[model samples]
Target: MKLYPIESGNFKLDGGAMFGVVPKSLWHRTNPADANNMIDIAARCLLIEDGNRLILIDTGMGDKQSDKFLGYYYLWGNDTIDKSLKKYGFHRDDITDVFMTHLHFDHCGGSVQWNKDRTGYEPAFKNALFWSNKDHWLWATQPNNREKASFLKENILPMEESGQLNFVSLPETEILKNSELGFDIFFANGHTDKQMIPIITYKDMKICFMADLLPTAGHLPLPYVMGYDTRPLLTLDEKEAFLNLAANDNFYLFLEHDAHNEIITVQHTEKGVRLKDVYSCSDLF
Candidate 1:
């Protein structure tokens, strides 16, 4: 199996929002903010090639939103999904499966795009079977007031409309062992309801697609949780358990939202689990 880190684009978000209640004095040391106090963010996606299947995890925020809407996030950078795919000699049509960790716009907006002639929306990956768990699908579609802004209809409904939407059946034990997608599924709820984190096995190494569960290395501390999370206290519990397991197993974390640091590993420290090393996909593969 081969894995590629597909960088869709970069954007800026309020550092306060990204770090939640964590003081700026702490998080700013790692993710330094701009004059406007917006921190650099990456819409980093992952592409996996296992035999006949070409699976993409998370589509990143697409370029369909109006300028006014995008201005809020301060989108930047020239990296795009198509360009990144071309770098690996692949195309969007080559993707057979799209496993969405969640339906937030930054994660799934590129799943759908404006059709030619700009009449209506359509699935961006026409050949891919977009995957989202049943419960998270409902939660995103019928979003609560707090999360409604992040779950945009244009970025989501088109997958179901194209008859390409599917769901991974959660196992009774919660941990899905040897999933057909060639990974173990870890269900995390603190960030959002039933968010699926794929723990992939490649070349004798366990690599985890750390979605919002661990956005950046700055969030390594136990108390650092995103304000956007529905349940912050629950996030603390989830992070503590996951970090312990990650530190113990020596797993490589594939960060999705960290702009500068591509991949990281954690180690048990006197304070808590802390960043051990940082590397990129090319360095490992």
Candidate 2:
């Protein structure tokens, strides 16, 4: 399978929020912040081509929200979902699957957009099957107060309404069986309950979509869990296990939220697991 780096857009997030409990002196070294303490973040995704399927994993935040709503996040950058797709000689409709890591706005917002008339919402990838696990689907649809703001109904419901919404069954007997998608699905609850990280195998290399599990290279350490994670302790456990596995196995981490680093490897340091090397996708392939 061929993988294309599809950059949708960039936005600024509060550095403190991104790196919970971690001091600014520590995180700012890698992800420097502005006067307002906001750091640049990328909604970087991938386009996967295998056989007859063209899967676009996690479209970035779309342009459907109100200006004021977007202003809060301080969205920036020239890279757009359509333009990046065009770079690979593809379009929105060409995607056969919209594999969402989770239904958070930045990850799944671009899956829906305003129809021409400005009257209603519609699926951005009309021909694609919108993919998410059933439990997370319910969590997002009927969001709790802590996550209600991140799970926008407009960005999510349109897929189910379009009759294209489908679930990757997670039976207790076969929980880690890769979710019927070709890639291995790493179920992480630290970010959200049942969030799936697609561990994709390509060209004799293991490329993993480090959804919110490892938002940026700065977040490589096992303890650098996000303040936004509801289950921070669980995140600590998950990161330690995942990072150790990545380091030992020499896996390429496909960072989804880091604006600068595309892929990185980890080294076991005295302090903890740290970034060993940074490279772009082209460098690897």
**Shift in Å, residue 15, candidate 1:** 0.4
- Residue runs of model 2 more than 4 Å from their true location after superposition: 171-175
**True lDDT of residue 108, candidate 2:** 95
TM-score of each: 0.98, 0.97
How much is the lDDT of residue 20 in candidate 1? 93
After superposing candidate 1 on the true structure, give the runs of residues whose Cα lies further than 4 Å from its correct spot.
none
Who wins the lDDT comparison? Answer: 1
Candidate 1, clashing residue pairs?
none
